[model samples]
Target: MTEIALRAEGLYKVFGRQPQEAVERLRAGASRDEVRPATAAVIDASFEVRSGEIFVVMGLSGSGKSTLIRMLNGLLDATAGEVELCGERLTGASAAQVRGLRRRRVSMVFQHFALLPHRTVLDNVAYALEVRGVAKDERLEAARRTVDLVGLSGWEDKLPGELSGGMRQRVGLARALTADTDVLLMDEAFSALDPLIRREMQEQLVELQSALGKTIVFITHDLNEAMFLGDRIAVMRDGRIVQIGTPEDILTDPANDYVAQFVQDVDRARVLTASSVMEPARATVSASSGPRAALKVMRDLQTSAVYVVGRDRVLTGVVRDQDAIRLLRAGTTGLASITHDDFASVSVDTPLSELFVPAVESPLPLAVTDDRNRLLGVVPRVTLLAALGNVSSHTGELPTVEPPPTVPITVMSEALDAADAESGRAVPSGAQEGAV
Candidate 1:
């Protein structure tokens, strides 16, 4: 079985005056009104984060995303239930236990960089190691390496004031990296940067994640950023998880009206790819072949279009069955006379989004090709639709409506008669004749 890096089961946290009493009252069946003045946080939430997975908890402000991250690292104790980190229970752990876990096993990067104004970037990163009792020289060396890893190689001696907002966040990331924890929790880590800088930071984080593979729980309110960074996003609404799935799953198949509205504006093609839509290519004929031979080939393949390749089997263009028909009617001598540049082509690496505008502008099927234009396969509209359907079905967003149950007239009458007998009701003579 895959090891879970973090697990929270029936976790509930409420902050207010007499919180314990409020919880007791609620457990005893008192309504929210009875606990209204005291309850300030989450309620009965559960999820697990697999080791090395980027599990994102995303929501608008006050939806409990921040509170959940804090509770994960034991910054705030759960009012009820348990939180386990790397197999260690945290719900009722002592302050020392929580502190030890924070120091050695988990680290967090917040929206604010939190770098000390007096410390240089190098010292800011080295602070975590210094507190852990490493020698000055060793801590400095480790910090330098971590700084380099986050693309801050030369900014080490500068104070936070000397760096841009993005650079300051890099310092914050370096600090966490220097701690060498198994899990990293990021709370709106790039939301403060300008759009351009935020994009750059997100890309940098993706690159870093690919290399590090640390179990990460990134909290963000931005849906686009969440889609880009998360392997699986847990969308929170009104203190509950509305849906959880991959970016492709969420965009193609939303779980409810809220989730559907959230993903409505997303460009589906940019998110879907060729590998998700391409079908195996069937055998085809060359454009230079005789028109009669090409017609026979099309008929044998049962295809409307045949991919035309050269002597080396490199794709030159496509020939349609209509072209063959026209050529045969006109008594054309060769396939070259019928071939035309009416087909659309795309590289295998091209994003599915790139094909949308062109596909709308033309009726031709999009051909998948290699860098050298060698035909790989074709993407038909039906294939794209089927792929979307598959994605939707897998994500539980699209309902699979079953056909209504069929009942014979005799069976219906028998059921009615049984109900009448149970009620001690008389059955009319006309009703018995109708049942027959």
Candidate 2:
């Protein structure tokens, strides 16, 4: 019983003089040529946008992304199928009903600024309120507040032509804000700006969306831009949806050759985060810690890396079972005698992109630490690989269990010995559980 803000089923749209006849032909399994128009704008599209979610549609030009958003807001009627907004059917809503729905429940921002050319920014924003019959003074007051919210506090009096393209888009956004709708549909709203301005606009949109918590459907052709802003992205091609998933899923585990090629060039480190890969810190010994201690700890644990803490319990280094055995052979006794101090460690707030460089550069698992330098957890490469695989499958389900604490060396050694015995195999002297 998850609440959905918007849902569409078997959504179909065709642009032509005989729209109904075209739909009838489609229902009868007629080819495109048998239909009235040569173009098939949308075909069998269906998806749901949850409340407070940013759902993005991305495709090349003429791929029906634009047409789809228009249908969502009742700007274009579906030639077939149905669209429901906030549990209300839209495909059959009357013209006046649709107008009221757009006015009170949905707002749209287009690639073009769409501001009135001759009106001041304030007036342009107030126009939406005016259409809803708010008092002149009240509409202006609301418009002023919205203008400030969009970071155009002092430019309320300036005309659209007087402002820069980015500023104009801000006015467009402010106008949408003034509508105060529960759903915001953006159709390439930032695509008209320069690259730098586009990035800034995208950031602003993210900030606004965070504060508003509205259900948003954003359309774009730039995959990176879509990834940056969308909670989920639906990729479209040839008037059909190819795949839908989070940016991490599309990048780490593509659905097929098409999606893989779509995200092949993305920096994997930049898009993946530590939370998805990090597990609870396991027990560790310093290089000075005894081999027997390390062995005991590894035997109790089923992990690959252990944090080596100093006397203060501050992270000093890390030790893997292989390294522990190597150190044991070299006559090392304590963890301090075997720990590797040079490795990548991440703070909790570190972005997924930033973790990649360190992860790739370090031979050991990535250690996670708090501000006080206490070990929080470790992220194994295998965990990251598995997370990527799950995301690629488009399931979008996160694992629920947290990794267990690190085991002491003695306990780990005993566990390993027991495991070998249970399996009827000889225990290797140096093969111990490593920390992760």
Give the number of the best model, judged by lDDT: 2
TM-score of 2: 0.73
Q: Please give, for residues 55-120, the per-residue lDDT of candidate 2 as tens digits.
A: 999989988999999999998888888998898888899999999889888899988988899999
Evaluated at residue 15, the lDDT of candidate 1 is: 87
Per model, state how many residue pairs clash: 1, 47
Q: After superposition, how far is residue 169 of candidate 2 from its true place, in Å?
A: 0.1
User: What overall lDDT, based on C-alpha atoms, would model 2 receive against the true structure?
Assistant: 0.78
What are the clashing pairs of model 1? 269-353
* Model 1 TM-score (2 dp): 0.71
Q: Candidate 1 residues 1-436, lDDT tens each? A: 9889899887777887787777677667675556888764666678999988888888888888898888999988888879888998877989989888888788999898988999999999999998889999999999999999999998998989999999999999999989988889999999999999999998988888889888889999998888878889998876667888987778767899999888777666666677557776664677568654664554454445677777656777667655665555554567776666667777775677677655444343467878777777777655565555555323445434332222333443454466457557775554434211
| Model 1 stretches astray by more than 4 angstroms | 18-34, 275-350, 356-378, 381-436
Poorest 10 consecutive residues by lDDT, candidate 1: 399-408
